[model samples]
Each structure stands twice: as structure tokens, then as C-alpha cells.
Target: MRAAWAIYKRELVGTFCSPLAYAVMVSFLLFNGVVFYFFMDLVASNPSLSGTRGPLQLFFGSTILSVLTLMIFCPATTMRAFAEEWRSRTAETLLTAPVTDLQVVLAKFMGSMTLYAALWVPTLLYALVVRRYGAVDWGALSAAYAGVMLVGGAFVSIGLLASSLAASQVTAFVTSFGVIGGAMFALGLGRYVFTEESQLRFFSYVNLWEHMEHFAVGMMDSRQVVYYGSVVVLALSLTVRALAARREA
Candidate 1:
């Protein structure tokens, strides 16, 4: 347990101390600020389009832009976990440490997630800014952030899983991006492939679009909780297994 915490702190410090972290932060804020301006402008130009009275609902996780942002940023964030170590032939050294594979995996995962959460922390300012201009739905805003974090969990775990498998950071990012994008495409394909209502409902249950929409409206579905939680566990478990396998190799 102590070894795990030590590994976690080491991973956390490695991630935060890197220049990549700052670059990702600046890029995320810059892109998101532009998206915010675009939405606010659209809403302002057509008053009726301001359905929720603020941009938080749309900006948090509702739009494809939000999805794309994650697709782009998360891979870069998690790619170096094991991939870089492997690339530099340090993975053997890392894995041979006293900590168990499970601890190492969890440590790297939590480190990536910490940075993921940091990227969203700035968006709280969006809520503050919205409050100054109009009545902000703080509950809904809170729910939106919660939903986004869960969504981040799903993707960040996937990224780390990919990182564990690949030999280099760039390859890890591509692997992570491809798998995540393919899964999303397959889910979207369900609309046309499954004609039955029950099948449709099942696919929708796993759909990121509806997941964010529900959260944006302050609707917390238990099914989504289970879905996201299950994905997180599955991905992280796979990561641990990958680390164990690598240790043996």
C-alpha cells in the first residue's frame, strides 16, 4: 500500500512537471474559449437559441466539439504513462520495482485522471462568468461537471490501456484515439443497423450524446452511473493485466 502511494505520487509528479501538461492546458483553454465565444455569439445573435440561458450546458459535454476536444486532448495526456517508459527501455526498471503491477497501473491511471480533472477546473470560471450575467443553474452545472468527469474516466482509462500496450508515446496516442473513435463510430452506426426499439434503447443507454444531454439537464440516470463505472473498472483492470504481462516478459 505504501509502495502504491509512492508510485502514485511519482507518476503524478512526472505528469505535472512535464511541459506537455502546460501545453495541453493552454491548448484546451484556447480551443474551449473559442467554442464558448462561438456559442455565445450564436445565442446572442438569435435570442431564441439561448434555450438554457447560458453556454455551460452546451459547452460542458453536449456538443460534438466537446467530444472532439476529448478525443484530441486525452490521448496526448495519457500516452506517456507506460509508452514512453517502454520506448526508453525504462519499463523493465519501472515494473521491477517493489510495487505490484496493480499498484503501478492504478498509479499511472490516477495521475492521468488528475491532469484530466485539472483541465476542467478552469471551466468553473465559466460558471462564475455566467452567474454575473444571468441566473446560473449551479446544480445543473455541478451535474454537468460530474458527468464530464465520468466520461473522462472512461476515455482516460482507455488511453492508459493503450499506453500500456504500445512501445512509444506517439503510437500509444494513435492506438488510443483509433480504438475510442472506432467505438464511437460503431455506436453511432447502431442507429441505422438496429431497427428494433429495444436494440435502439440499449445502444442509446451507452451513447455519449444522450449521457451528456441528460447530465446537462441535471438528470442523473442510474444506468449511466453503472455504464461509466463498469467501463472504468474494465479498462483499468485490463491495464493492470497488461502491466503484469509486461513484467513477466
Candidate 2:
């Protein structure tokens, strides 16, 4: 635990020190600000467009853009986890340390998760701003944030897995982006093509769009929890295996 904590601190500090991390943070805020502005414009043009949904819900995952934000920045933030270590030939030193593979993976994962959470912190003001003008459903807002965290966790794990497979940060970013973006596109397409209840159910099971919608409405389905939990576990497990194989090689 002590070793893991040390690695975790190093990882977090390293990320904060990187200029790319700040670039990502700024870009994320800019993109989200534009998205929210667009939503407000939409509601202004057509008051009925939002209906019962609040800004938080629409901002979270009700739109494709919101999901795209996750698909893009999550990879951007995690691209360097292992890829940079390998690129600079520092991975060998880390791997050869006294830390076990599991501890290293967990520590790095937590570090990435912490950074991911930081990226979302500034957005909380969006909620507060909304509360001042109108009624905000705190329960749904909390659920929406929870859902975003789950999605971020899953994406971070996938990004780490991609980093493990790639030797450079750019390659890691592209790999993670393609895998996550492709899956999201494919699942969304499947949702439309499969109109049958059973088929739609299957798509919905893995559809991030549906997951966010459920959360945005305060419908905390246990199935949604299980789905994302499985994704996080599976991706991280594969990441651990990938690191082990790399070590052996």
C-alpha cells in the first residue's frame, strides 16, 4: 500500500507538471462551455426543447456532444500513463521496482482517476448557476455526476490498456480514441437499427447514451451500474495482464 501510494503521488504530480494536461483541461472547459451555450441557445429558440430536463441533465449525457467530450478528453488525459514511461525508457525502472504489477496498475489508475475528477470540478459551478435561476433536482444532479464518474473510470481504464499496448503517447491517444469512439458509434448505430425490444435492450445495456439518460432522469438502474462496473473491471484486468506481458518480454 505504501509503495502504491508513492507511485500514485508521482503519477499525479507528473500529470500536473505536463503542459499537455493543462491543454486538455482548457480544451475540455472550452468545449463544454460551447456545448452549454449551444443548449441555452436551443432552449431560447425553442422553449419547449428542454421540457422537464434541466441544464445539468442536458449537459451530462442527454446530447451526443456531451458523450463525445468524454470519448475525447478521457483518452487525452490518460494517454501518457504508461506510454510516456515507455517512450522515455522509464517504464523499465518502474516495472523493476519493488512494487508488484497490481499495485502499480492500481496506483496509476487512481492517479488518472484523480486527474479525471479534477477536470470535472470546475463544471460544478454550472450546477450552482442553474440552481439560482430555477429548481434543480439535487438527487438527479448527484446521480448524473455519479454516472459521469463511472463513464470516466471505464474510459480511463480503456485508455490505460491502450497505453500499455502502445509505445508512444500519440499512438496511445489514437488507439484509445479509436477504440472508445468506435464502440460508442457502433453501439449508437445499433440502437437505431435494432428496433426490436430484445435487440434494443442489448444495445441499451452497453449504450453510454442510454446510461447517461437514465442517470440524468434519476433512474438509477442497477443494470447500468453492473454494466459500467464490468467495463472498469475488465479493462483494468486486461491492463494488468498487458503490463505483466510487457514485463516478461
Index of the highest-lDDT prediction? 2
Query: What's the lDDT for all of these models?
Result: 0.82, 0.85
Clash count, candidate 2: 0
Tens-digit per-residue lDDT, 1-249, candidate 2:
999999999998899998988999999999998887776666657767667776777887677887888899889888999999888988889989998888988898999999899889998888787777667788988888898898888899999999988989899999999988898546756877888999988886888887878888777778877877888899989998998888778
Residue pair clashes in candidate 2: none
**Alpha-carbon runs more than 4 Å astray in model 1:** 247-249
For 128-197, candidate 1 gives per-residue lDDT tens digits of 8767766688898888888888888888999999999998888999999997778853585576578899
Query: How does model 2 score by TM-score?
Result: 0.95
In model 1, what are the clashing residue pairs, if there are any?
none
Prediction 1 global C-alpha lDDT: 0.82
Off by over 4 Å in 2: none
